[model samples]
Target: MPVAAVALVAGAVGAGPVIAAVQGDPALPERTAEQLLADAVRAARSDPRPMSGTLMQTSSFGIPGLPQVSGAGGSSPGALLAGSHELKVWYGGADRIRLALPGRMSETDLVVDGDRVWLWESGTNTATRITAGREDLAGHGRAPGDRAAEALPTAATPQQIAREVLERADADTAISVTGDEKVAGRDAYQLTLAPKDEASLVREIRLALDGETLVPLRIQVYAEGSAEPAFEVGFTTVTFSPPAPENFAFTPPPGAKVQEKALADLVPGPVGGQEKGEELADGAEVVGEGWTAVAVLPFSEKDLRGLASQKGQGAGSADAGAAEAAVESLLKSAERVDGAWGGGRIVRTKLVSALLTDDGRLLVGAVTPERLVEVAGQK
Candidate 1:
């Protein structure tokens, strides 16, 4: 199974109720770091199971003057960058899943059942239906349900996050079994991974794996020199019982605007309609690897200004306005700097740094400003 598929399965299993015996730090035989890592990998490849739970995500990047919006409009990028969010999830094997994000006065739902997928936003009374391709339905590649999972506005589940982190583990990373711990009232083993490169802004990543199932129950990311976690996502409640089949069923209300899409429409093509194996159409790519990786994107100053001033003319305009104001404020507050790479604006936070170059590129990563500059100079 793919790593993401494993994450889905593991996340589903992690939703189950904890046994009474493992409520606290239950005594168990000590396992080496290697042993624990192997166990996690094996568990991820196991068959999917039924599970349901509530997931909580929080972030404190220490970005100065960043707006923290909540309530019904919290799904915006600015809102998700800060504050807290709660999501309810249900999983029944690979082809069935449901995720609901509730707000003060509205709710958003993503439901996937076999080859059909639905995204419904109550605030706007809009429904989007995506038909899965044959490959997705056959489970030969990325599934529509997985795409739905990625479409989540908030951070992914602990299992998914852990899978991404583990995939980047290599010689540059130092992995260890920190100790026994409990997460969401379940007994767990705490695993920690720290980057050896000093240039990486990440201090360490901690994952709590269920002792019984080896599924990730919680993930915490700490920035360099920070004692507290900069970001965290974990389950607050879990139950192993299968979700009702009706949860995956969705129907657009009367008078609701319905939009249809196909799975192929979501896939990105090569640059300038080039054939496969050509450059990316977006003129974007990742530089470096592992913890030191930096993302290079084609972004001009005009684009930045346009994004800051953009406004929505229809439904959800309030949220769009708020997001625009936040972006405008962030741009106004950004510091201008001239370096060997060229003159540009830089935004630095406790956990991440971004440099928008004068030459129409944006270099960003969870590394230091120096790393961004280094990557920019290479271009």
Candidate 2:
């Protein structure tokens, strides 16, 4: 699995959450949904005390053949353990984990002086250079999780709700206080913010605010077409001060397989040609349970880059070419069943990743070869 995950990082896009729906109850508020939302934002920002904490986040989903584990069968869990004093975050995914810390951004005496971001892998023996953005690691490097958490306090926060997606609220939003609940053992108020339309990516944001400071203990985001809960974040052992000086250095173990190229530079580009058979007519209907198969012909090639699931994954730098190959293999493997296309009944054929990328894309709505033939012959 680790091998596959490494392969996927070279090819797939990242992941995010499904926003919830915003059906406002009449008892919600008179200030309008957006207004109430603004109030909540103000309350969050008013929290002057900076905070640092460790966050353990987990998510899971069902897969075709793999036995169910956590969250759901196919879903996977991700975690971020961060400390404020050092401005570092330890990120853990299903197959891999890494630690990151502030660099040139802080006012410290360290001589390793931040010129580049650094990364180290346990499986590999060396540290690699990473691109630190212009503003990143400049003052007090902003951890990605920090940025995400900070955005939560701003009304400008973007979210997805069901079929609707709200980018930035332009005062047209409304907000109000609802009830209260216990979050991680803290007394909290329930605040709801609603967007104006059903299309709003965030239907309603239900928050559990700390009663005394109004710091959010938890937040619930609703979106369309997602049964899964909207994303949630929490902090523990949090401190608002700068982290220790020694926290930001990346010392790869001896003999690490250190690569000098930027991540993008190392990745291969597009492969696979658009042959007559390879190119599906525009609007041609192709369906499969495997996200990869559905990805190449019917969906844009770009989508293949972001593929993730429980099956095949993590085939490092070789993924793009591999994906093209996989597309061809899938196309040839598919048979027609009474006018419908189907692959074999391993459910969706388990993806065979040569190098392993992240989870290979799940092929959905696929049919078996015999079934496909039967269906195509009839029509």
Candidate maximizing TM-score: 1
lDDT of 2 by residue, 285-356 (tens): 333321112222233324443452211355354534554555545444433222233222222221121111
Among these predictions, the greatest lDDT belongs to 1
Global lDDT of each candidate? 0.67, 0.33
Which consecutive 10 residues in model 2 have the weakest lDDT in total?
75-84
- Clash-forming residue pairs, model 1: 16-240, 271-281
Write candidate 1's Cα lDDT for 1-379 as tens digits. Answer: 1122211221100111211112445455688887888787777656545888888766667664455433223443223444566778899867798988777677778788887788787777888886655464343354446554544534367777777777667888888984557667667788888889998888888888877778788877777887666676777787777999998888899999999865445333311123323444378887887777777889977886576555343427675676566566667767897877688888887667788888899987778888888888888
Q: What clash count does candidate 1 reach?
A: 2
